[model samples]
Target: MTYTSRIDLSDHVRKQACALLQARLSDALDLEAQAKQAHWNVKGPHFLQLHQLFDSVHDEIEQFVDLLAERITTLGHVADGRITTTASATTLYGYPLEATGGEAHLKALAGSLGAFGKAVRVGIDQAGTIGDADTADLFTQISRETDKQLWFLEAHLQAH
Candidate 1:
């Protein structure tokens, strides 16, 4: 266990950081689920590419969830990675039950990436305000990765 009495933050600051990370982790989990859904249901000519892309996206999101959890736990707080916690904390729209073709799948994935990227950017800014530069850096890394995935997914939707 790591101890850092030197790092003194008000309860509000700590709470805010915890809340931000909790939100991020939740969003990451939601993204993972949606990506898996897309991976499983994607079809059409670009099936192979989209299927692989969604799996990559899911992996990235899962990594972010673990990183955020570790950071929150480092701050002397309990990290919640459970389904109920993620459902309550996430801001993502519900995943559709019906299977969709490549274009619809890309649209949904792109929208999700955009929303998750915005949240991560906001969280990074909030963490920086409280002097938590490391957390901000982590979110920055996450944002970049999300954007790359967004690019890859969006490219598949463009005209040939």
Candidate 2:
């Protein structure tokens, strides 16, 4: 249910933007948890580097989670970020719990980051099409950061 707000957008537009934000919020929360999992479980020769990188990724995604949830509330909708909600709503592939090595965690995380980045890019366009430039800009900012984080993860997977 949408609460009354002084924001200029119509209920329809706000609802659409809130739905989009909610979906991304779920993904962000799931992604954050996956990063923490990698941080905690990573082993092998590159353990230190991989562990630090995974922690950093988790930190960044925590910010994204707050941003997405706040945006939903700003648009006058409740942001449901519970783990059960995220488990059910997230579009991201499940992180591999069996992944214990650097390469394994890296690959798993890169896949998730790639998927989240792709969805956020779509959200940028969707928000724009729905006439909410602010929401679109928020998505744009997130997409850029997600791409950078994906690059960091992919770099480790590269043989060079």
Candidate 3:
């Protein structure tokens, strides 16, 4: 349900933006948990580096979670961030529970980041098409940061 708000955007636009934000929020929450899983389970020679990097990724995703949820509320919609909501709504492929090595976790996390980044890029265009420049800009900011995070994850997977 949407609440009454003073924002100039029409109810239709706000509802569309909120739905977009909610979907991304679920993905962000799932990604954050996956990062933490990697951080906790990573082993092998590069344990320290992988552990730190995963933790950093988790922290960054937490910010995205907050941003998406707040944008939903600002659009006058409830931000459904409960764990069950995320589990059911997230578009990301499930992170492997048995992934224990640094390389394994890195690949898994990178896949998730790539998927989320792609979705956020789509969200940017969708928001713009729906006539919400602010939401589009918000997705743009998220897409940029998500790309950087994916780069960091990919760097470890590269042989060079």
Across residues 1-160, which tens digit of lDDT does each residue of candidate 3 receive? 9899899999999999999999999999999999999999999999999999999999999999999999999988999999999999999999999999988999999999999999999999999999999999999999999999999999888975
| Model 2 agreement with the true structure over 1-160: per-residue lDDT tens digits | 9999999999999999999999999999999999999999999998998999999999999999999999999988999999999999999999988998898999999999999999999999999999999999999999999999999999877876
What lDDT is reached at residue 68 by model 3?
Answer: 96
TM-score of 1: 0.89
TM-score of each: 0.89, 0.98, 0.98
Give a tens-digit lDDT track for model 1, residues 85-152.
88887898877666579888888888988999998998888999987787789899999988898998
Q: On TM-score, who's better, 1 or 2?
A: 2
Q: Go through the candidates in order and give the C-alpha RMSD of each one to the true structure.
A: 2.5, 0.7, 0.8
lDDT of 3 at 94: 99
Q: Candidate 1 or 3, higher lDDT?
A: 3
| 1 against 3, candidate with superior TM-score | 3
Error of 2 at 64 (Å): 0.5
